[model samples]
Target: MINSNSRSVAALVALLVATAMPAFAQPPASPAVPAAAVTSDAGVSGTAGSSRDAARARRKANRQLVKRVAAVLARTRGLDSSRILIRAADGTVTLSGTVPDNMQIPLAVNAAQQVAGVTVLRNQLRIGMRME
Candidate 1:
């Protein structure tokens, strides 16, 4: 009689486990992302691409301005551009690096200011040896 009771309890426990197995195997429902959220994400990606393109164009323009300024400085009388560095933004120019003579500092500033695209000039030139 005790053996039969033990067998019945074991069967009941097995049944409960068998019923619970399917619930554990199936995945729970996941909330779907909103359509507007997906659209905004795509828009943001496009904006980022356009922003990068704009930044690249600006850098190219700045480089062109620097080259123009450098050429002008090279053509100027008694100004050595070998040790001078030129950087340009929208319309602002920064002249850095070394010049052999103090007089050349003003010469560089004047030449850079005359460039068509240069609306502002920052003279950071120092009288020193060539910087490698």
Candidate 2:
């Protein structure tokens, strides 16, 4: 049996390491979590039999990237208010669904292009398709 003092110290060290490791704390989140997992009402269409918790976390991270892309487009190109939808898979952002106009599409693509952690931009956007 170990001494109580030494055991406590070991536990404390473990906690410190866990907390200090930002990479461990912020692993890749889900692809459907929405702008800020804690806030966005976005839902996941994850693969069957997948862990809900893991999927949600993954989506949350993707949503954050989507949010940044949207913000960048909105500020730089004035196009975030459109119907363009964005999703991320391991830093590759795919813009899909629909948008307001042809101009908005490229603007959105370029916006996603500028964001950090974005490896590529896949435009699945159908120009002029209503997103109702």
* lDDT of the candidates, in the order given: 0.78, 0.66
Residue 48, model 1: Cα distance from true site in angstroms: 1.2
Give the alpha carbon lDDT tens digit for every residue of 1-132 in model 1.
Answer: 999999988987785576446446643322344554334476587866676687789889988998999999999999998878777878888787778889899998888888998998988677764423
Best by lDDT: 1
Error of 1 at 16 (Å): 84
List pairs with backbone clashes in candidate 2.
29-57, 29-58, 29-59, 30-57, 30-58, 30-59, 31-59, 32-59, 33-59
What does candidate 2's lDDT look like per residue over 20-75, in tens digits? 46434544534454543353233533432255566667778878887887777668
Task: Please provide TM-scores, in order, for all candidate models, with all chains considered together.
Answer: 0.65, 0.49
For model 2, state the Cα shift of residue 94 in Å: 1.0
